[model samples]
Target: MATGTGIGTEIQISDSSDEQVILKTKMIKLDTHNWVQWSCQMENYLTARRYDDLFMPPSEETKRSSKFRQKNSSALALLWGCVSSELEGVLLDNKTSFYDTWEVLGNICGKNSIVTICETFYELISLKYKPESSLQAHIHSFQKLCARYNSITSDKVLKATFPPKLLAATFIRSLNGDKELTGLVQTLYDIKPFTPAAVISRVAIEHSRRQPNEQALFAGSSNKSMQKTKWDEQKQRNKGQRSGKKYDKPGPSDKNDSDKRMDNIKKMLEKLQASMKPQSAHLTTESNIKTVVPTLMLS
Candidate 1:
């Protein structure tokens, strides 16, 4: 018997004449154990090889494999199903491991996958798992649609993308207080910067001119009430940062208004004294006449 065969992993033969003969066979099956073992096996198979035994830190190669990076909508559908909609506590049951799986999922598919995944997962529960027989006719259709989309494989583009009606329908089905739904919405919001959001920014800016408002959004436009807010916050941070440095003693720029007024008075007095001198008499006379005539003529 082989070393791994003791727990039912391999096959063994009693006598072999050139050709191999199977005396006994062993296989892992769902009948004996629930999905826990199967899920673990699937997860391991996906993440086995890595740079380091302790931790395989992120890098370029790791990112390329993410389902999130590929924009595979199916990944989103499956994620929403398992985690957001809590498809039978499937994701939560092995959360630690699931998180590990999610890291890879996000790296490959792009985070948008989460929203679709959650929506699809909820549909699966409502249509197939829980609906009473009366409204259950579409159950098979639902599963059939989801069969190839469980979690989005990286190497293929088989089943069609869900149409907007179907996609939106699935998401709205379980509007259950699934916290992950918030994350999914956030992902959708972030990925749509190039679409209607661009137009929305222009419209919002026009509205801003008519009303007082604030938010640091609009990428380059003044609509960045949020950016302005952040800039203000950053300015405060910079002030604190400068305060921390061992700066030189305050310079002339730090002088008070009184000091500036005194300096201006001194300059004026010096100018008046210079003008009163013998050499400045002509200039003073001309200046005095120019100053007096304007007031006299106006009066």
Candidate 2:
């Protein structure tokens, strides 16, 4: 029967053997604390089904847009070098947040679209995204920084954080040398106020540089991706399947669940004391250190 959109519990599993042996089985439900788990599971499902719904072909526009979408500093530096310095201007001005002390500036204004937002002191992320808007709507803030830096600096974008795969992609692109992007090499370092579109162009150029010998970049990208994924997988394993708790370590909930908690040594002492023959066990000085004095001297 169709249990509908939400998860339905009481899933059943059955096991049977020959000779009339029967046993009850248990059910399993899947959910995680965050969307990452949901996304990974969804990807696994799609891969298993061989679904081709969302495969996007590489496009100049998409490539150009990727700088802003680039992974954070760790991956960006390995992929691009110091040529990505223009990223400094892309700094997030977060003076606002409910949970945080600073407030967030909410505008999608670009150096290109200076007409819309009149604010002179800070940059804005618009707190929202729109396709027709000057800035990219859904792109992550850091990814755009790479694009903005690359665009203004051209092909010469240096990055503080780099991913080896991005370098591999760039190295492969270098083989073709479309010289049309000749100026791009210089612009990545251009430390001037620029727009989101400039960022997109830089990213496109970077990807184009790899398009010539796509195979190597592809392989490098794939291997590096796998390595990265492996690292992430290792991280998830650490997260979901951490090493069993140490003998002395207590879980976060242990403080609240004191009633269910056990003092192994105390329990053992009680068992030993109860099992011992009358007065068979005598407390020594070392054991007496923890002994309780029941009587008090007269004041």
Candidate 3:
């Protein structure tokens, strides 16, 4: 039997031709969330099968053989199966060459934006282990995010000036409080050329060796509940302030002062209107007298 790794699993093929080989491989479907890793795996699989040539347009001079056509059709079907339902709709009417299909999918799924890549990198770097989750699960999540970041950034020129130890230390610092694991990670970081894989392996071993503590788990849960309670209280306080019910509620003195200001504004407007009315009356009377005096002089 020969063993080989494909995608996310190990496959063992029987040496005997008569024996049926059971292929074990995980189907990594392409979706918006996992396009990067899916594209990487598909590229690897295609390159391994020498089907990468299908990515180029067929030359006019080249005559297609029946065997080549069959293989190409089969490859297309396999590629279609790997795509998600939404992508399948996009590719439904596509009956063209594999290269055309590949290009279409690339255009649709390949974000390749520098801003998107930076956001993904930031998310990976800022990943924190949830208190409710296991150490192994958290590590797996970190690895997946790291893989995604790497796939998105594979084309970009990254700065490798930082030492491996520094990288490992940074990752350890991001992890939640696990004193024993943190100490182990520090010790591993002290050794030069500490790779992420090495740190992961050591952490896994240490995690497995340590027994589960009911008390610690309970304490973590309690802390989470306490945090949630505090958040709820803060949220309620914010709501009260927004509604002007609690923090910003008007006091008796403030209400009286506001009423006094309004009254003063009203009195000022009344006085101004009274003064304008008298001036209007005086102007009208003076105009009437001038007209009467002109009539008397004419007579």
Candidate 4:
């Protein structure tokens, strides 16, 4: 069956094998965060397989052709497989052509309105690093938000307000005062062409260094505390020994020497008393003889 020509030139399907080959090739599924990239990839895949014409309306000659309807249905089925389940429900009741469906999906997920773009831009600028979240993950999320906002907005707006320098500055300002990250951001701003990717890489490296450095510091403090405790204990033990030595009393041998000194003083006093008694006896006998001789002379 012959199909009608569309916006792109009519692709004459001469062989069934080529159709099967195109059908067999898997397409990348779309997600909310990656719609822009996914759409680009889908366009490239459709163009490469010469099936892009299926997305456009048929020409006048093929408007009533059954073969054109069959071709559109096949292309729609393939497109359905490439979308996520969340988007499937939105497009399920859509009775439009493949091109209309594609546009609808883009509008829904792409958020092409100026308000949406501005909101996304504000969110990117306001994105802050959470202590519980990973630093690298936060940086990556901000980068993706910036990319999406840039894709939606015009180059003039981006250049005037959200330039690369401003993006880098915003990212640096959102950090939660990590010294390594702050220093790296400062270095990045000092250099020419402030690239966000460089800042992300430096942040990852700094995060890795910070973990080990913090661990080492903690271990060092623990060791110092333990050493201090041991030193204090030793000082107390030495002090107790010195106190015991300073107030220590004498033993049994010292008591025996003191008793021996008291006994020697008593023996010396007894010897002097015994010698004085012999002299006293001689003087008494001499006095009695003198008294008797005086009585005889008087008679």
TM-score: which candidate is best?
3
lDDT of 2 by residue, 18-56 (tens): 325322222122221112222233334333433222223
Candidate 2 local distance difference test against the native: 0.34
| TM-score per candidate, chains pooled | 0.18, 0.16, 0.50, 0.49
Error of 3 at 268 (Å): 99
Candidate 3 off by > 4 Å: 1-26, 44-50, 92-94, 156-166, 177-202, 212-299
* Pairwise lDDT winner, candidates 2 and 4: 4
- Per-model CA lDDT versus the true structure: 0.40, 0.34, 0.62, 0.62
Tens digit of per-residue lDDT, candidate 4, span 92-137:
7664467667877877776355556666777887888876457768
Model 4 TM-score?
A: 0.49
Q: What does the lDDT come to for candidate 4?
A: 0.62
Cα error, candidate 4, residue 215 (Å): 7.6
Report the error of model 1 at residue 282, Å: 19
Off by over 4 Å in 2: 1-259, 264-268, 283-299
Worst 10 residues of 1 by lDDT: 46-55
Higher-ranked by TM-score: 1 or 2: 1
Error of 4 at 69 (Å): 4.6
Runs of candidate 4 with Cα error greater than 4 angstroms are 1-15, 19-49, 55-58, 61-71, 79-96, 108-111, 154-161, 177-188, 211-299
- Which is the winner by TM-score between candidate 1 and candidate 4? 4
